[model samples]
Target chain A: GAGVSQSPRYKVAKRGQDVALRCDPISGHVSLFWYQQALGQGPEFLTYFQNEAQLDKSGLPSDRFFAERPEGSVSTLKIQRTQQEDSAVYLCASSLGAIIRSKNIQYFGAGTRLSVL
Target chain B: DQQVKQNSPSLSVQEGRISILNCDYTNSMFDYFLWYKKYPAEGPTFLISISSIKDKNEDGRFTVFLNKSAKHLSLHIVPSQPGDSAVYFCAAQHNAGGTSYGKLTFGQGTILTVHP
Candidate 1:
């Protein structure tokens, strides 16, 4: 009955520092995704995972960004050597495999607000 | 190039009037389209969706229409209410993997103000 949730609702990091954001998807959800949204902009795809296997990471802005879903339900997005340009809200979403077989809605989390100084 | 676009940045309408939000996509591969609404301090919530296979789908007060030839989709809300005021985002997926996981693209979003 719980919705997708993210941790550290707000994070302030210095430039060049590393930050980690966490996401806990709904129980039994097989699909997890991460996205980045700059102010006044739409959320952009970052990466995706089906269970413990990453299906895509093409949306990662650069090499400094990394994400993993080791146990399959919880996911983490890591940004290393953060820059001012990296400041944005990081969103996480999940859905049952039904979205794959057809069109299913993605449940989103409140998101982690990361500010790079 | 942006795969999904919401040209109108904002719109204001009187309550009880129909509210129409439009979205355009340049990528022809996108076949599944969705609409989401968000209020301040919250993540987006799903509003409606329309697949390429169907030209239109309706659910209660919301309806989504897709025009594949134009690569456009529109969400229509009949009798819009003040509570409907929010930023609306249009999203699409290529459906390459059959499941929409890694490649859903979203529009810039349109802020709607419904005055009661």
Candidate 2:
């Protein structure tokens, strides 16, 4: 892919339902990042993957949130028992660098808008 | 604790004027700072970035300034355009004895509206 691509650009979920958001990063990009953006706010870091290793997930809001990059190519963010606060845009980005020093611009995908009612 | 903070919620500016957005971080360990511009229906685009080693970095009309002493950083867009109106986010990365290579901590964004 030329840039990061995400699925289900808009999602409306009922309270307590489970929703899965998917992200397909640029081909050969070694770094992947997920973020949550509330209305009128910046994208907050959620999780990151370097290859298949989920090295840092400290930003996940709760245990109910889970993300995985099984093949080091595509990734999924699953939210269990979604709450109203979960209504927001979920963004996924990928960069060329493996680490911060070498990290090029983080190319972002059109995020998935999850609306929890 | 919000290690990164953007106190301004919104700013209105004329299209031709320079727009200044500010950000502050608490952690001194953060070595790099980045600014991102986001549109309504699209993901944020990386506008510019500044490493701690340099106080200023310029790319075209966008310039970023870092002040380690004040724990502050700012983004300046000269002759702002209506297309530049978007929510801008400031981010910082801290890698001190951590397994993470590039973990970004971001602040609540400041929305910039460049009216033509």
Q: Which portions of model 1 miss their true places by more than 4 Å?
A: A99-103, B98-102
* CAPRI verdict (incorrect, acceptable, medium, high) for model 1: medium
Question: For candidate 2, lDDT tens digit of each residue in A1-114?
Answer: 778999999999999999999999999988899999888767788998888889889889999899999999999999999999999999999988654464566889999999
Backbone clashes for every candidate come to: 2, 0
Residue runs of model 2 more than 4 Å from their true location after superposition: A99-103
Model 2 Cα lDDT, one tens digit per residue, B33-108: 9998887798888888888989999999999999999999999999899999899999887667455557677889
- The model with the greatest DockQ is 2
Across all candidates, the chain A TM-score values are 0.95, 0.95
Q: Which residue pairs show backbone clashes in model 1?
A: A100-B98, A100-B99
Candidate 1, what DockQ?
Answer: 0.63
lDDT of 2 at B55: 98
Q: Write the per-residue lDDT of candidate 1 for residues A7-40, one digit (tens) a residue.
A: 9899999999999999999898888999999999
